[model samples]
Target: MIYIQLFFSFLKIGLFSVGGGYAAIPLIQSEIVNGHGWLSMQEFTNLITISSMTPGPVAINSATFVGLRIAGLPGAVTATLGSIFPAVILVSLLSLIYRKYKGTTAIDTVLGCLRPAVVALITAAGLSLSQTALWGELPVSLSSVDWTNALLFLGAFFILRKWKWNPILVMCLCGAGGLISFLTGKFF
Candidate 1:
């Protein structure tokens, strides 16, 4: 039953999420955190972080992790297969007719419209995580924001802008900083 839920939830996300991996974040978060209660808000944020850092697309990685969390290895397989099903079917079918509409202005216009919607979805996911990190649990006062995190975020943003360093290096540094902070009682 849990496996079925995981498969169908991800399958719905795959079917309806119009854009690529990042675009699925909002829906995946909603399913994992809000809809099914499969993951906590913090877990969802961690999932996003881990997914972004891993090799494959964010959506696939997340589906696999969430599925594993829910029902172990079998759930992981089920969720991954479910998530890719829509894309596989649609792309295969569309490939045959793609040439006919490839030159159409309508196709272009639809995609142009879709771009912003995808951005909005990604933005919403970030906002949800921001709320979780900045404020305590939901339905609570926002009196105690983590000042240490605020400072680190600002510092990282400016450094990234100025240095234009590789993202993997930045992530590594952040991870190290987080570990140090945790050790020092600034975090945790």
Candidate 2:
């Protein structure tokens, strides 16, 4: 029963995610955190962090991790399949349709409209993650804010913008800085 739920939940995420994995974060949060009560917001935030750090899309990574936590290997398989099924089917269909309507204005207009929507989805996901990443919750209150994390974020932003450093290097440096801060009892 849990396996079925997991599969269907991820299937829903896959079907309507639209605009890739980052865009799916809100849906994933809604389904797992709000709808299903499977994971806490903190756990979901951690999942997003882990998903981002690892290979592959965040949605698929999240599905695999959450499934493994819920019901082990078989659950992971089912959840992953569910998460990818819609994309596979839709892309296959779209490819054929796009080929048929190679020069149609309607299709072009549809794609143009979707671009802004995708941007909005990605932006919303980023803002949502920022709340968790910086404050660890929704309806962010100043009292709960982590000053260390906020400082690191500002520093990272500054260096990235000013020096135009490689993102991977910046990430590594930030990770090291976080570890050092934690070890030195600087981060609270």
Candidate 3:
């Protein structure tokens, strides 16, 4: 039953996760965090970080991770298969359609229209994640903020934007900073 649930949850996620993985974060959060109560907001944010840090698409990685957390290895496999299944079918059909309508204006118009919505979705995901990261507690109190995370977020953003540092490297550096801070009791 859990396996079936995981499968269908991710199936919906994969089927509707247009504009790739980042855009799918909100949908993942809705299904996994809000609807199912499988993971808390903090855990979901951490899951996003871990999913992004690892290889492959974020949506698929998130499906595997969440499934594993909920029901172990079998759950992971079931969820991953669910996540990929829709993509496989859709891509195949879309490929055929694209080949047939190679340079159609309708295709261009559809894609052009989708771009803004995708951006909006990504922005929404980012804002939610930022809220969770910067303000660890509710009510948005001043003392509830995680200063270390805020610093890391700012510094990482600066370095990535200013110097175009490799994202993996920035992730590693921020991770190391967090680890060092935790180990030394400097900040959490």
Question: Could you tell me every candidate's TM-score relative to the true structure?
Answer: 0.90, 0.93, 0.96
lDDT by residue (tens digit), candidate 3, 43-141: 999999999988999999999998899999999999999999999999999999999998899999998999999999999999999999999647798
| Candidate 2 wrong stretches, greater than 4 Å | none
**When superposed on Cα atoms, how far off is each prediction in RMSD?**
2.0, 1.5, 1.3
Q: Which order, best to worst by lDDT?
A: 3, 2, 1
Q: Candidate 1, residue 151: CA error in Å?
A: 2.0
In candidate 3, residue 132 scores what lDDT? 96
Name the lDDT of candidate 2: 0.91
What is the alpha-carbon lDDT for the whole of candidate 1?
Answer: 0.83
Candidate 2: C-alpha RMSD after superposition: 1.5
Tens-digit lDDT string for candidate 2 (8-119)? 9999999999888899999999999999998998899889978988899999999999999999999999999999999999999999999999889999999999999889
Q: What does candidate 1's lDDT look like per residue over 76-174, in tens digits? A: 999998899998999898787777789788988887898899889878876776676666476646467766566566667788999888888888887
Top-scoring candidate (lDDT): 3
TM-score of 3: 0.96
The TM-score measured for candidate 1 stands at 0.90
Ten contiguous residues with the weakest lDDT in model 2: 131-140
Give the clashing residue pairs of candidate 3, or none: none
